[model samples]
Target chain A: QKEVEQDPGPLSVPEGAIVSLNCTYSNSAFQYFMWYRQYSRKGPELLMYTYSSGNKEDGRFTAQVDKSSKYISLFIRDSQPSDSATYLCASAANRGSTLGRLYFGRGTQLTVWP
Target chain B: NAGVTQTPKFRILKIGQSMTLQCTQDMNHNYMYWYRQDPGMGLKLIYYSVGAGITDKGEVPNGYNVSRSTTEDFPLRLELAAPSQTSVYFCASSYSMTLKSANEKLFFGSGTQLSVL
Candidate 1:
């Protein structure tokens, strides 16, 4: 099974709508969950980050992780057309004293229509 | 800081041809990684290094090799290009995985699009 699973969504939403994106994982060892936004032909950029199972809020973006259920979510409030991009979920196991490599999900393409 | 820079933004390779994808970071990060993103697929780790002189294979490492001779440079080499190797390659770096600050984020390069024919 893939380590991380996300719907490759071409999810279209009206401007100013609240957008919720989700991902499921199979590795319980993953300790760091991250959300990245990527525009066409560009690399992924870090949008939100969370550690373990909890919720973190950053302005209009919130990241939630439920280790028990092996699920994670990213909520974007007051979405705008500029928010239209591919959202990728990534996770990594925290090494004792180092940053481990991250595993990513198939990105979901989001489009916000004005 | 030009966080991470990748060279040869795009390339087209014939079968059996070889090339190198260059990556350089000015953040003085200790961890560097190479990943490839295929169409509609998640990014797959090709190789990673925690520090200069140390390298490890990731989820997908075949048909490629990497060397970290210095802290600022990590290059991926394609010895014999194959059609299956065509993909967008990304190079990333982080200060350290153990840090707790949000700024200790993974910064990625623009990406190198490779087409192996």
Candidate 2:
């Protein structure tokens, strides 16, 4: 199994609708979770970040991590057309006092239609 | 703060040709990384450095080499360009990865698109 697995979604949702993007990981040691948004021809930009199990909110985006289930999610409230982009989920483990390398999922393509 | 800057936004190279993708960060970050993104895939790490004079390989380091003589620069060199080496490369940096700011501190460069013919 891949360390991280995210659906390669072309999930189209109408504006103002709630959108949920998710990823599952095989490693239980992953302690830090992140969501990045990538526009066409641009680099991935950090959107939401959370540590271990819990929820974090920033404007229209919400990041959730469930350590026991080894799952993570990014929810968009009142989605908009501007939100169309590829969403990548990344995670890293803390090994002793050092941080391990980050592992990324292929990414889910989201299209918020107007 | 130009955060991170990478040169040669686009390039086309002949097979077996050698080149280096330049990257520099003004953030004074102690950690720097090189990653490549292929079509319809996630960014795969090539190499990373925790500090100057220290480097390590990530998931995909073959065909690529890197050096960190200073905190601001970490360049990736392709000794023999191959068709399989064609991809968009990105440079990123961060102060440190602590539990509270583990994933929050990273900053990325726009990227360099390279094509191997």
Give the best candidate by TM-score. Answer: 1
For candidate 1, the per-residue lDDT at B101 reads: 56
Per residue, candidate 2 scores C-alpha lDDT tens digits across A14-33 of 99999999999999888889
lDDT by residue (B37-112, candidate 2, tens digit) is 9987888989888899999988899999999999999999999999999999999887774546745456889999
Clashing pairs in 2: none
TM-score to native of every candidate shown:
0.95, 0.94
lDDT of 2 at B68: 95
| CA deviation > 4 Å runs, candidate 2 | A96-100, B102-104
Model 1: which docking level applies?
medium
Q: What's the CA error at residue B61 for candidate 2, in Å?
A: 0.7
**Model 2 lDDT at residue B27:** 82
